[model samples]
Target: NQPGEVFYTEYTYRPWIQIDLQQFIVVTHVIKRDIRTPKVPPQDLYGMYVSKRQWDFVNRGARACFFGLTENEYNCRRPITGQYVTLTLEYEQDSYLDALMDLKVFGLPTGCGRSLGMTTGDIKDYQIETSSNYKDIHQSRAMQGIEGWCSSATDMNRWLMVDFIVPTEVQGVILHGWYQMKRMFIYSFVVEFGLQEHTLRLYGEDGLDPKIFTIDSIQDVHILQKFMFLQNILTRYIKIRVIDPSNDIACFKAEFIGCQVYGNKL
Candidate 1:
């Protein structure tokens, strides 16, 4: 006996559920299960967002229907490529209604580690003056058994840049704001990715770096905020600039997740 789970959305347009495998995978298939004898059947479509040189969006929801008693399980055997997969629900009526009993994603491992930030090069401008090396965003541990990246209180122009030491294929990035400190939580920020060393220097100068991918309205405070790229990007630098710190100060722990696709660049 499985618990009946209903997935619904409010008055929203194109509401979706994006899942990050944290690394690239050869997706064999995706199985979406629905409950039987339920109030309403799960009527939603599926799609894949794969990355090559850029992001490619494709609709793979071949056939989606419901059968009584035993719910119909939708299976898409489209071998998609990418690190991040977004499962979108399409409805006939205006109201957004759907149900999900379970979801199973079958794929092969890409042989990538957990966090790439551990080996990243020097972190820049996190703190004007370092103390106890506490401002080190690359450190995994904090003082008193706490774990986080601390920023200066008055550093209005604050940013954290991650250097891969080489051009590497990046899957995604995760941000964990200081949960213990209420005022240090970040509400909004900006992300920039670059492939050249000169671009990295120009980006820090302000209004210079070309915006490869940027998201402005992030409201997740003091929690693990994640952004998965649809396609793998081979870049040497990644930066996160604080915009609306929400608390006049910004502090966080960051993780760069991906793998080295090729050997170190010369």
Candidate 2:
């Protein structure tokens, strides 16, 4: 029996048993724990452990749609609750395609909690948008005597590590760059981030895409966004793309603050 399954006649109640739909939500925390701190346990002392990966996000209503349950489109509903959802999260790191990252179920935390997000569905085939497609802005909107200009460092001769500092709790990050160079030379963009428990990653094999670029490296390697890479990883540092070789210098001046860590025993 299913919801709106055309109740030929009548049963005890409407086949549609309205149960709360679990809205898969994720919370994150970032910690800087150094086990080497004198008396700080042994070499096996971690900050925290998020024993659970898949969580339950409850969606309530008698005849509303659900987060994970498809087919129950409008005018229909399903039954489910208190059920631990199994997840196969896929990070949508593709900057070219417009996609929603998928089910990053759980986190085995350590040190501190940074941030996370609550989402619905199996987003295995989705990606995130990185570059802004502002191609329709009226040229008249441009400032008088303004010229279309771009600032570049290292240019195509260097690899730039594009790092993203997402506010705590933010689960998605979209990276963007240009491969406008008219060459077939090989290039690589690496994306990696880890917080003891949670993780985020994105990468690409080559760079020749003149269009959108995406990376779903956090999860799967299939489905690319134009030149997009796909990655569905649960981490505070959700985005980071770089190709800076030791020989290269001078990257685009991106605004960011730096912090220092010290070993205090007092």
lDDT of 2 by residue, 184-215 (tens): 11223444444321444343334433222334
The candidate that wins on TM-score is 1
Candidate 1 matches the true fold with a TM-score of 0.52
The 10-residue segment of model 1 with minimum total lDDT is 62-71
On the 0 to 100 scale, the lDDT of residue 57 in model 1 is 30
lDDT string for model 1 (18-56, tens) is 556755666665665654454355334433343321223
Query: Where does candidate 2 stray beyond 4 Å?
Result: 1-73, 79-171, 175-188, 196-234, 242-266
- For candidate 2, which ten residues in a row score worst on lDDT? 136-145
The per-residue C-alpha lDDT of model 1 at residue 258 equals: 73
Best by lDDT: 1
RMSD of each: 7.8, 20.1
Per-candidate TM-scores read 0.52, 0.22
